[model samples]
Target: MSFLNYLRVWLACARYSTVRTMMFRFDFIMWSLVELFWMTVNILLVSVIYRHTREIAGWTQYQMLLLVGTSMIMQRLMMGLFWSNLFELGRNIRTGQFDFFLAQPGNPLFMVSTRKLDLDGLLNVLVAVSVVAYSAHQLGLHPGFGDIVTYILLILCGLIIEYGTLLLIVSLTFWIVGSQGIEGSYFTLFEFSRLPKEAFRGASNVIFVWLLPVVLVSNVPSKSIMHGVDARYVLWLLGVTLLWLLIGTTVFRRGLRRYASASS
Candidate 1:
C-alpha cells in the first residue's frame, strides 16, 4: 500500500477501536480516577522529598516534577499505543496467528504494535501534561521556542527508545518460547526508568546513561526545560535514539527469519 493509504488504514483502525472503548464508560471513569490518584501521589512524593533537600539528582523540586510528568506521559503513550499489542507478539508467533500480520501489505511491525488502543491510558497523558504545566508555572520558568522544540523532539525520542527496548525484549520469544521469566525481567527494567538515573551511583549510573539510556528519555528533557538547552546533550540524545532504532529493527528482522509458525 502507498504511504497515504497505510496512514488512512491506521487512522481508521484507531478511530474504530476508540469508539469501541467509549462504550465502557464505567471502566473508563474508574481507570481515569485511578490514574489521577496515582498522578497526585507521584507529585506529592516529589514535594515531600524536596522538603528535606533542595535538589535530588541535581534537579530542583519543580524540575523533578517536570521529569516525573514527562516520564508519566511517555509511559501512558507506550501503554495506550504499543504495550497492549506488542506483548501479544510472542503468543501470536507461537500460535501461528502472526501469519496474518505477515500477510498484511503494510509494515508488519507497525500493524502489530498498533493493533489495539487504550483510550484510558491516553487520558493519562493529559493528566501528565497538566502536571508539567503546573510545575512550569510554579518555577516561573518560561521556555523559549527552541527549548519547546527540543523538548518535543526529546519526548518523541523517549517514546521510540522505550518501544524499541520493549520490542527487543519481546523479540527474544522467538528463541525462548514460554519464557514467563522474561516478562518479569522486562518490567523490572522498566521500573528502574521511573526514578532519576542520577540517583544511581557509579557503574550502574554509567550503564543507565549509555547502555540503557532511559535517563536521556526523561531526565534530559526535563533538565532542558528547567535549566537551559545544551547542544551536546541534544546531539547525544538524537544519536542514541537513532542507534537504538537501528539495532532494534535489525534484531526484529533477524528474529523474523527464525520465527517458526505453530504449524511447524
Candidate 2:
C-alpha cells in the first residue's frame, strides 16, 4: 500500500482506540496517574541518591534526571504507539489470530503494530519532556537549534531501537510455546537504560553498553544535549538502530512463515 494509505489505516485504528478509551474514562485516568506516579518515583530516587553523593559515574542529579527523562520519552512513545499491539502479538499468534493481519491490505507488521494507541502513554510523554526541560534549566544548559534537532533525532533513534528490541523478542513466539516470560524480561533488560552509562563496568559494560543498545538508546541522546553532539556517538547509535531494525523485521518474517492460521 501507499504511504498515505497506510497512514489512513493507522488513523482509523487510532480513532477507534480513542473512542474506546473515552468509554472507560476512569480506567484511562487511573492508568495515567499510575504512570505519572512511577515517573515521579524515578525522579525522587535520583534526588534522594544525590543527597548522599555528588555524582554517579560523573552524572550529577539533574544530569541523571535528564537521562531518566530521555529514557521515559522513548519508552512512553513506544508504549503509546506499539506496546499494546506487540504485547498481544504473541497471544494472537498462538490463537491463530495472526491470520487477521495476513488478510489485511497493509503490511502485516505495520498493520499489527499500529492497530492500537495508548493515549495514557502518549500523555506521559509530555511529562517526560517537562522533566527534561526542567533538568536542562537546572543545569544551565542552553542547547542551540542544531543541538535541539540532533537531540530529537537521537530520541527518535532510541524509539526505533526500543520498538525493534520488543518486536524481536515477541517474534520468538513462533518457536516458543509462549513469550510471557521473555516479554517481561524485555522490561528488565531495558530498565538499565535509565542508569548512567559509566555506571557499568567489566562484564556489565560488555553486556549492556557494548553488546546491547540499551545504554546507547538513552545515554547517547542525553549526552548530546549535555555535552553537544559528537559524530562518534551519533554514528554508533544510528548504526545500532539500523542493525536492530533489520534483525527485528527479518525475525518477524521468518516467524510468520512458520505461522499456522486458524484455518490451516
Candidate 3:
C-alpha cells in the first residue's frame, strides 16, 4: 500500500478503537473513580510522611507531589498504550502469530505496539494531571509560557525513556518465554518510581540515575519544575532515551529470527 493509504488505515483503526472505548461509559466512570481514590491515597501517604519530617530527600512536600504526579503519568502512559500488548508479544512469538504481523503492509513494530489500548488507564492520567496542577497551585508556581514549553518537552522525553525501558524488558520475553516472573519484575520497576530519586543514597542512587534511568523519567522533570532547568540533565535524558531505543530495537530484532512458528 501507499504511504497515504497506510496512514489512513492507521488513523481509521485508532478512531474506531477510540469510539469503541467510549461505548463503555460505565467502565470509564468506574475506572475514573477508582483512579481518583488511588490519587487520594497517594496524597494522604505523602502527607503522613511530611508530618514526620520537613522534607523527604531534599524535596519539599509539593515537590514530592510533582514527582509522584510525574511517576503516575508515566505509569498511566505505559499501561494505557504499551503494557496491555507487551505480554502478548511473547505469546505471539511463541505461537508464530507474529508472522501475521510480519505479513502486514505497515511497520510491524508499529502494528504490534499499537494493537491494543486500555482506555481505563486514561483515568490514571487525568488524576495525575490534576495532582500536578493542584501541586503547582499550592506551590504558587505558575508556569510561564517558556516553562510550559520546556515541561512538555521534558515530559515527552520522560515518556520516551519509560516506553523504551519497558520495551527493552518486554523484548527479553524473546529469550525467556513463559517466564511469569517477568511481569513481577516490571511491577517492581514501577514500584521503584513511587519514591523520589533522592531517597536513594550513594551507590544505589548512582545505579538508579545511570544504570536504570528511572530517575530521569520522573525525578528530573519534577526537579525542573520545582527548581530550574538543567541543560546537562536534559542532554543526559535524551542520550539515555536514544541508547535504550537503539538497544531495544537491536535485541528485539535478534529475537525475531529465533521465533519459530507454532505449527513447526
Candidate 4:
C-alpha cells in the first residue's frame, strides 16, 4: 500500500480510539490521573534526593531532572502509541484472535501495533515536557530553535528504540506460552533509563550502555539538550536504533510463520 493509504488507516484507528475513550470519560480521567500521579512522584523523589546531595554521577539535580524527563517522554510515547496493542498481542495470539490482523489489508505488524491508542499516555507526554522545561530553566539554559528541534528528533529516535525493544519482547509469544512476565521485565530494565550512565559501574555500564540501548536512548537525547548534540553520540544512537528496528521486524515476520490461526 502507498504511504498515504497507510496513514489514512492509522487516522481511522486513531479516531475510533478517541471516540471509544470519550464514551468512558471517567475511565479516561482516572487513568490520566493515575499516570499524572506516577509522574509527579518521580519528580518529587528527585527533589527529595537533591535536598541532601548536589550531584549524582556528575549530573546535577536539574541535569538529572532533564534526563528523567526525557526518559518519561520516550516512555509516554511508547505507552500511548504501541504499549496496549503490543501488550495484548500475546493474549490475542494465544486465543487465535491475531487472525484479525492477518486478515486485514495492511501489514500485520503495523495493523496489530497501531490499532489502539491510550490517550492518557499521550497526555503525560506534555507533563514530561513541562518537567524538562522547568529543569532547563532551573539550570539557566536556553536552547535555540535548532537545538529544540534536535532534542525532539533525538527523543523520537529513543522512542523507536523503545518500541523495537517491546516489539521484540512481545514477539517471543510466538515461541513461548505466556509473555506477561517477560513483558514485565521490560519495565524493570527500563527503570535504569533515567539514571546517568556515569552512575553505572563496570558491568552494569557495559550491559546497559554498550550492550543494550536502554541507557543510551535517553542519555543521548538529554545530553543534547544540556550540551548540543554530539556527532558521535548521535551516530551511536542512530546505529542502535536501526539495529533494534531491524531485529524487531525480522523477528516479528519470522514469528508470523509460526503462528496458528483460529481457523487453522
Candidate 5:
C-alpha cells in the first residue's frame, strides 16, 4: 500500500485508541498527574545535584538539566507513540491476541506497533519542554533556529533508534515465547540515557555508548544543540540508527515466519 494510505490507517487507530482511553477520565487524569509529578521530581533531583557539583562528565549544571529534560521528553514521546503497543508482544503472542493483528489488512508488525496511543504520556511533553526551556534560561544560552532544527532532527533519529531497539527486544518473544524481560530491560537501560556519556568509564562507557547506545537517544540530542552538532557524531548516530532499524526489521520478519497461527 501507499505511504499515505498506511498513515491513514495509523491515524484511525490512534484516534480510536485516544477515544477509548478518554472513556476512563479519572484514570487518565491520575496518570497524567503522576507523569507530571515524576517529571518535576526529576528536575528537582538534578537541581539538588547541581547545587553540590559544577559539572558531571564535562556537562555543566544547565547542560545536565537539558539532557535530563531531553530524556524526559523522548521517553514520554516514545511511550506515548510506540512503547506500550510494542511491549505487548509477549502477552499478545501468548494469549493469541496477536492473531488478530496478523489478520489485519497491512503489515502485522506495523499494526501491532501503532494500534494504541497513550494520551497521558503525551501530556508530559509540556513539562519536558518547560524543563528544557528553564534550563536554557539558567545557562543564558540563546539557541538559534539552526540549533533548534538540528536538535529536532537528532531527537527524531534518537526516537527511531529507540523504537527499533524495542522492536528487536519484543521480537524475541516469538522465539522465547513468554519472555518479556526485554521490556523491563529497556526501561532499566534508560538510566544511562539520562546521564552524559562522559559520566561512564572503561567498559561501561563502551557498552552503553557503542553496544547498547542509550546515550545516543537523549544526551546526544542535547549535546548536539548545546555544542553545535558535530559531523562525526551525526554520522555515527545515523549509521547506528540505520543498523538498528535493519536489524530490528530483519529479526521481526524472521520471527513472524516462526509464528504458529492460533487457528492452526
Candidate 6:
C-alpha cells in the first residue's frame, strides 16, 4: 500500500480508539489523574532524595526529574502504541490467528502492531514534556534551538530502541514456552531502565549499559540535551537500535516459518 494509505488506516484506528475512550468519560479522567499522580510522586521522590545529597548518579534533582520524565514519556507512548499488539502475538499464535495475520494485505507485523493506540498515553506524555521543561528552567538549562531539536530526535531514537527491545522479547512467543512467565521476567528487568545509569555498578553496569543498553533509553537522551551528545555515542546508540530491530525481525521470521511448518 502507499504510504498515505498506510497512514490513513493507522489514523483511523487511532481515531476509533479516541472515540471509544471518550465514551467512558469517568474512566478516562480517572486514568489520566492516576498517571499524573504517579508523575508527581516521581518528582517528589527525587526531591526527597536530594534533601540529603546534592545528586544521585551524578545528576542533580532537576536532571533526575528530566530523566524520569523522559522515561515516563518514552514508556507511556510505546506501551500506548504497541504494547498490546506486540504482547498479543503469543496468544494469536496459540489460538491460530497467526495465519490470519499473514493473510492480511500489508506487512503482517505492521498490520498487527498499529491496531491499537492508548489515547490516555498522550496525557502522560504531555505531563512528561512539561516536567522536562520545568526542570530545565529550574536548572538554568536554556538549551539552544538546535539542542532542543537534537534532544527530540534523540528521544525518538530512544523510543525506537525501547520498541525494539519489546519486540525482541515478545517475539520469543514463536518458540513455544509459557509466555506469561517470560513476559514477567522480561518486565522485571526492563523496569530498571527507568533509573539513572549511575545506579548500576560493576558487572551490572557493563551488562546493562553496553549489552542490553536500556540505560541509553532515558539516561543518555537526558544527558544529550544537557551535556550534548558526542558523535561516537550517537553512532553507538543508532547501531544498537538497528541491531535489535534486525534481531527481532530475523527471529520472528524464523519462528513464523517453524510455526507454519508445524501447523501444516
Pairs that collide, model 2: none
In angstroms, the error of model 6 at 67 is 1.0
Tell how far residue 31 is off in model 3, in angstroms: 4.0
TM-score against native, each model: 0.92, 0.97, 0.90, 0.97, 0.95, 0.91
lDDT tens string, model 2, 13-108? 999999999999999999999989989998899999999999999998899999999999998898799888998898888788888789988799
TM-score of model 1 (CA atoms): 0.92
User: Which residue runs does candidate 4 get wrong by more than 4 Å?
Assistant: 262-264
Please provide, for model 3 over 1-264, each residue's C-alpha lDDT reduced to its tens digit, 9 standing for 90 to 100: 777887787677667668877898787778767766876787899999999998987888988888888788877877777776776876687676878988887777777887777777865888788888888888899787888778777777777767777677777777877765575566677666778876888997888767987777787777787778888887888888788788877788787777665685
Off by over 4 Å in 2: 262-264
Overlapping backbone residue pairs in candidate 4 total 0
Candidate 6 Cα outliers beyond 4 Å, as residue runs = 261-264
Query: Cα deviation in Å at residue 230, candidate 4?
Result: 1.2
Query: Candidate 4's residue-wise lDDT over 1-264, tens digit each?
Result: 999999999999999999999999999999999988888888898889999999999999999999989999998998899999998987788788898889899888889999999999999999999999999999999999999999999999988998889889989989886555688767887888989988989899899998988999999989988988899999999999999999998898989999876455
lDDT of 5: 0.84
| Residues 91-112 of candidate 1: C-alpha lDDT, one tens digit per residue | 7876779999989988888888
What lDDT tens digits, residue by residue, belong to model 6 across residues 24-137? 888888877887787788778888888999978787888888888888778778767877778787677766777877887887778888987877767688888988898888
* Model 4: lDDT of residue 83: 91
Q: By lDDT, highest first, what's the ranking? A: 2, 4, 5, 1, 6, 3
Q: Over the stretch 1-264, how does candidate 5's per-residue lDDT look in tens digits?
A: 779989999899888988888798999898899888888888888889988988888888888889999998888898788978987876787667888888778877788888888988887887898889998888888899988988888888888888888888888888887585767877788767888888889998789988987987786788777777788888889898899899888999998899895554
Alpha-carbon local distance difference test for all models: 0.81, 0.92, 0.77, 0.90, 0.84, 0.79
Q: Give the residue spans of candidate 1 off by over 4 A.
A: 184-186
How many clashes (backbone N, Cα, C below 3 Å) per candidate? 0, 0, 0, 0, 0, 0
